[model samples]
Target: MNFKPRFVALLVTLAVLVGAAGTYIGMQYFGDPGGQKQTANADQGAQNFGSLSEEEQKEFLDKVGNTDLKKVEQAYSVIKDNYVKDVDQQELVEGAIQGMLDKLDDPYSVYMDKDTMKQFNQTIESSFEGIGAEVSMVDDKVTVVAPIKGSPAEKAGIKPNDQILKVDGKSVEGMELYDAVLKIRGKKGSEVKLQIDRPGSEDLLTVNITRDDIPLETVYSDTKTVDGKKVGVLEITSFSEKTSDEFKKALTKLEDDGIEGLVIDVRGNPGGLLQDVEEILKQFIPKDKPIVQVEDRNGEKSRYFSELEKKKDYPITVLMDEGSASASEILASAMKEAGGYDLVGTKSFGKGTVQQAIPMGDGSTIKLTLFKWLTPDGNWIHKKGIQPTVKVKQPDYFYTNPVEIKVALKYDDTSDKVKNLQTMLEGLGYDPGRKDGYFDKETVDAVKAFQKDAGLEVTGEIDEKTGGKIEEKVVKEVRDDKNDLQMKKALDALFK
Candidate 1:
């Protein structure tokens, strides 16, 4: 299927960073608090057409006298009447629509035909049938925001900010976020090949992932003893329909269990519904300040507040990383600025605008970026993400690139792949003798040691299979609690 015509552009994804849109009605705003605040006029970035609210409609109509669409109509008529080759009128019209959105330079404002919207609704409405990862258009390239936890994307070694070069050999260079997702989406058990440009790799990485039903559990909770105090850990994977209720239940249980503090972990979380995250924030943020402030195009700010009269008796710490975005960012900022809680971890995937899903009543939809949501302190954290109060990054091994082996790597070989292999070996407790990209005899011995322990033939050589195994072990080590320096710091921050 030529997905280009179906979906024009998108900023976020629920394929796990597509926009966090719920069921679309006439027009519903969804971003930070939920939905958009359309522009007052073209000057405010609202198009000459679409209006999600009555105010936007009135403003658009008021500008109707000043703006001339006769030129647009005349151009369309000229093209349809005089163009030598016949053009699909629908295609031309859609192109014009997308062209306008593209010129806005905002990927969040997008148009989706019925077919694309159906597929999109199917994914976000329920289980997604695709490579489990959240992606966004960053600097016009389709970048992986974060792989779904324990999904095909994560299993294939996909990481946050991975710029997707191709899908099944087709370059997605200029495709919209959703259009790229259409290329990545497939049936369960079917493999999808992705070529990615990761941050630190010397070359592009090629990964093959079998599509599957992505994880939707949303909330995970447990308790641990830190400083002789029971510290409750509530890990929010995503803010879906049921996520707020799940969080409430988890928090209730933790509070009932006599926890002295809480660690709210939103690490690697892409984003989700606004209501879900807002609800979760209300539980922590008191009435002293708004949990979030929504700024419209007219420089008007509307603050949303929780009715809670007091803060939580116990201290709270919010754990966030670069992959934590959208609604995750909402929670992180609110906790930091409004709730006065400590934020621990690296920076966030900055997305400060909210999008509105406007229904055409034909199952087609347009997601338009309209509002810029500010942090509680009126700080616009759009491109500038919310910085951590106590920044704690993971180990160097956690950020290593995949070891793509085109040829078997034997002793005396030297390349970037060899350097990656050495890092993994060292992370796994084997001594490779050198961190430089050189495969010495000690590196060969390290591979042999890993091979023997992994039950593979002790061939002292790193093959494609060996590389895959090494990547898998490295991912496991990254997920290990003992290696999670951020979580340790978060737990420790609660006490201070």
Candidate 2:
């Protein structure tokens, strides 16, 4: 993750798309200014970036072709001088930058104006207040990549891939990624209402989340006992500045305590510094192979390797899911490929390119995609995520939707809401009989049993209150450690 800066910038992005994702970032630099004939030493571990020497500046400008800039200037003049009304010249300039980025069609590549750039830098240097979730621009929609573990977004049931349609009653359709994120982020204690469009659901959901000071600490350590053996579980919520060091301490303590195996859980980690993941990978991966490979625009590659001569003696397993992304993916891929370990859970959130934030000489910044990161085995898992060796999906109730009660759901009623309630009932051991959205006689009996056990009215019909209680219980069950089948699978995989 350490880039030898070549004066001109191109780099491994240590930061998130900022406002879109709560993941933090730091500036990194590397470059190949083009114009010159770039040679490929594909096997080389280090690269001399296409010589950014003084003599090449003219060649670089010549290669850029002045015709495009001339055309842009022509358009600016036509609009500014002959338009219907006066225009903010600065706005026009900003629009030109944004327009060029839009043509690239890369959501990660964005323009951060003066104020936005300041806030973005501040977020990385310290902390900010928000709903604690990582979002991305997918198919032109602002979609939730993953909610931060234990954040308000996760507490409010904001799942990955939820397309945010509005924020605080305002439609964000066609809004820029930063603008949309700004609307969502606010001071702690302020409330933000989100209208979400989730896949596989019939109705759009409105989630009310109160913003809070998103936690900066990224690592959590604990122990799990399985089959009379102590196993250490390190859950990385994200890979921030202190993550790698924190991870080292946790691992050391676990080792000192004499653990049989380890579970590296990156289930809901959106992502952070690439360097942090690389630093962690060195602990487990042998030095024989490169930890990861970086491919630049000219198709030349730079291989990065760890100096470790040996791997850990104890068995290791990586736990991941759809919410796992970027640096999280890097760690999981390295463990599976180089360390010869097992991975448990569903596929990962694929984001393979690296970015660099370049100052535009005016307090503005252009966060540009610079390189594509390949796995140790040379796999580019861009849109295609890494598949787990052992895929374990959570219980059906965990993915169920909240019931929207317009009227009481009686035995004759049949709807998606009823089906969700049935799944919840079944998950909690209430024999709902059928789960196909049909509220049959068996479902009624199941509801009655649940109601009686909970000391409710036992009406045999699902009212608003009843549905709310059922949803609450379902969420609780989903959170319970005993019900975490994926963790169990990951731990078992370690032994296997």
Candidate 3:
């Protein structure tokens, strides 16, 4: 025998012997060594390769790489033995799967456990009772941005910008947002007490509300003018059911008003009902134009188009702010793409992902992001906001001064003006009860009575004309006291 050939044969036999021993050891310690036998068998069924083809090698490697049932069983056994706490084997397995999914770090990608999955399914098919408020955590506090109109939250007098301090006597501090929401929401007729704090108030307010079914309505419109232009201002708060019908009515009113322009205010509106947005856009966009495209998993794509014909003839301006989001952005983008519309105010709050409310078997649902939306112009406004074409800021002092006078009253305060007015009214036989700075009912009554007696319009309004007469009377009476600073200041302010 050739020593080289003999030595090679011995080495090959030794390698096979070692593999056999290792397999036996794995089988003895672990469970079934043949657990993956079917997989290995199927992989080995592949035939011939061209000069040890890459495909053949891959198939071979895949078959033997992790196919040893014994080794896999041993690995699981090791984990069970080494795990520090008593673990539910099923839970461990599910947790592992969930952990893998969590690596995606997507808020939408979730593993619904048995109970959660059931709840999610149920929420989709039927209405579940809950407090009618869309609540969110802002700056670590539960804040109510808006109470769903006509919902229990609104009925209970919950207003936007209210900070919830406690829910049902439990402090909400450091609680998870969803957990807080769940606690607040319950079956119909269930009552929950909320401790809230509102701005410009000194005391914490408590409100008790009952859970109820909340139906979200989408489109709302009213005829109003902007800049004396007599334009129809359609405020589409959200694209919901009946939105298209509402839009049609608004359009008809605009036509009847001889409106030449339109201002669609989408400020502070969250999106709803994709179909409603599509239908509303029909009033502005031409039919057959692509409105939006949703690209989902598996590389599948779906496009929504405008089926609109009778386009409204008007100069369109969309008013938007940071609070305007979702369906609002869709409508705004569509109008922009259709051409001849101006976007005003601040950039929008960009939420460009599409979420589907998937109902579990239980009475809860999970809103998961199934796809992302892109504007017809190919703009992705997910985290980045939509920019306005013409930015208009509200003046800070707009509400500081009196815009209108619905009622008028007289002052009898100790302030020099009040004292002078009182003394003058008394001299004129229009006795204002006291010279106090307070504007009491007696003072108002006396002013009205004086207006009536003087044959002046009994509006009880202390306007420039009435004030002038009162000042003249006071000056004539007080001319001897010329050095009065208070009287001079009061007169200066009133005259100016």
Candidate 1 TM-score over all chains jointly: 0.86
Ranking by TM-score: 2, 1, 3
Candidate 2 overall Cα lDDT vs. reference?
A: 0.76
> How many residue pairs clash in each candidate at the backbone level?
11, 2, 17
User: How does each model score on lDDT?
Assistant: 0.74, 0.76, 0.53
**Worst 10-residue stretch by lDDT in candidate 2?**
28-37
Query: Stretches of candidate 3 above 4 Å error?
Result: 1-104, 108-131, 135-166, 169-178, 186-215, 226-230, 245-259, 287-289, 296-303, 309-311, 357-367, 393-496
Candidate achieving the largest lDDT: 2
Runs in model 2 deviating more than 4 A are 1-54
Q: Tens digits of per-residue lDDT for model 2 on 232-277?
A: 9999987766788999999999999999999999997777777888
- Candidate 3 lDDT, tens digit per residue, 1-496? 1122122222222222222000000001000100011111221212222334685445434544434434444645666678788766655544443444345444333334455435433442334467755444456677664454446775565654578889899998876444566677778888999898876344476777887775444445555444555566677654545666878787787779787666777765545556667777766887656787676665466777766675666666777766566677887787776654667766876667665433222232223355677787777787687887766543221101111112333443334344445555765567677755455667677778877766677755565566655544544443333433322222222112
Sorted on lDDT, best first, the list reads: 2, 1, 3
Q: Estimate each model's TM-score.
A: 0.86, 0.89, 0.50
Give RMSD (Å) of candidate 2 vs. truth: 6.5
Question: By TM-score, is 2 or 3 better?
Answer: 2
lDDT of 3: 0.53
